[model samples]
Target: MNAPAYENGRLALMLNEPRLPTIGRFWPEFAERSDKEGWQASRLLGALLEHELAERAKRRIERHRTESHLDPTKTLATFDFGMVPMVSKAHVTALATGESWLEKGATILLFGPLRAGKSHLGSAIGHALIDAGYRVLFTRTSELVQKLQAARQSLQLPSALAKLDRFDLIILDDLSYARKDQAETSVLFELIAERYERKSLLITANQPFSGWNDVFPDPGMTVAAIDGLVHHSTIFELYVESYRRRKASDKQSAPATITMEARQL
Candidate 1:
């Protein structure tokens, strides 16, 4: 029945209390509505709290998506599951929910040749995971390797990895594109080893596990990295024709491509 004094409310705002802004904005309307409709105080408070929580959730989802570095255009809605028959829509949907593998710190490997929708699928799942309130980071394998190498040079590798540890999931796109340099591969292995069983990884690669030898300098390290990755992992082998090539072919087959000369005639 009692309300905080104006000075006390100002102090709460200065102290940055949660939901105070929402309460301040809605309390008068809520009171008026309750009085007019004979609503209970408990019901009004519950509605206000629910609204505050929903706002907080929306802000958190926005922050996660911005920090994730995922491609905005690539999302589950845009991904054509029928076009990539090699990939299972059910399996992708399950993973996108970030329930089983992501929770258990397992890996999801998308293996296929170029333009097989690997990057799109991985990024779409990253977006889904972001919506599901999971922190995610999407980076190209080469860019990540370069960052690690730079961190090693600066003697800040530990700090870098520690910062990376904050993310629940990391989407490494195009894993096989990174050059097979010893320094780069070493730090890449360190990242894999550090996150082993601690965080989840979603990788899109153009090469299979056996072909990873071309990406690593030493066979032993390659095996170790592969072991750590696949020990608790789900592999999706996408062996369809290149999506880009198919699109090009469709464009070529379209009837709208008549020459300007023909139109003029």
Candidate 2:
């Protein structure tokens, strides 16, 4: 075994670089073949780095998909369609397929019962935009209003609104889910008035405009809210059942989703 001193010399040359994990894993073999495969190590190292970079990009895209649309807090897999509006599909297809038409600030709305697919549809549209590499944002109606107020309280409301405008499509989910105080209602109207005819908007609400008085409190504010929201909006009224309860009834861990139109008018 001690007869070949040349073998040890060849091993030393191949083992020269110990930094690369890929190379270190095969160090012994590489060292043995140093003379015949001397240039191969450098080429192999380059290839390894390229693969790693590509994988990293893939992970980043996936994270964006989840964060921007799916909402890391919600699960799309749990969306149930058993209670989706019958006519919801047509409007959704128009929005999803005709995203190009959104440049002029087309609007979409979802008015439905609790446990219906309002937020789901809104998020789904947001997800579609994200898939197309377009900018999108989703926020609960109450939460976004609170954020705007918080920004104003901190003297940064304008800065916050500027970022809102950056997104091509913004989904305001669960707008009337909770009763709004007078101040919150006024802030909500102001935000709507600003976004009106400026960008594509998706709003989901359980209460119809006729019930607006309860939330807006002021008759004038109610008119303002409705005018801004409906002037350039596609309104969807979902009279469907509770998709969530449907799943509960079946005792199926998996949910079945339905996408249908609520009504045109």
Q: Highest lDDT: which candidate?
A: 1
Q: List candidate 1 segments past 4 Å from native.
A: 1-19, 247-265
Cand. 1 Cα-lDDT: 0.86
Candidate 1, 1-265: lDDT as tens digits: 8985556467457535654565666666776798899998799989878777787789889999999988899999988887788778898888888877776789999999899988888899999998988999999999999998999999999999999988999989998987658888899999999999889998989988888988897999989999999999989888898876876787786755566557878
Q: Which stretches of candidate 2 lie over 4 Å from their true place?
A: 1-63, 69-85, 88-90, 251-265
The clash count of every prediction, one per candidate, is 0, 9
The per-prediction CA RMSD against the true structure, in angstroms, equals: 4.3, 10.1
**Candidate 2: Cα lDDT at 259:** 20
Clashing pairs in 2: 81-257, 81-258, 85-260, 86-260, 86-261, 87-260, 87-261, 88-260, 88-261
User: Model 2 lDDT vs. the true structure?
Assistant: 0.69
What does candidate 2 score on TM? 0.66
**Considering summed lDDT, which 10 consecutive residues are worst modelled in model 2?**
256-265
| Candidate 1 clashes between residue pairs 3 or more apart in a chain or in different chains | none
lDDT of 2 by residue, 171-218 (tens): 888777546788766767777777777777888889888887877888
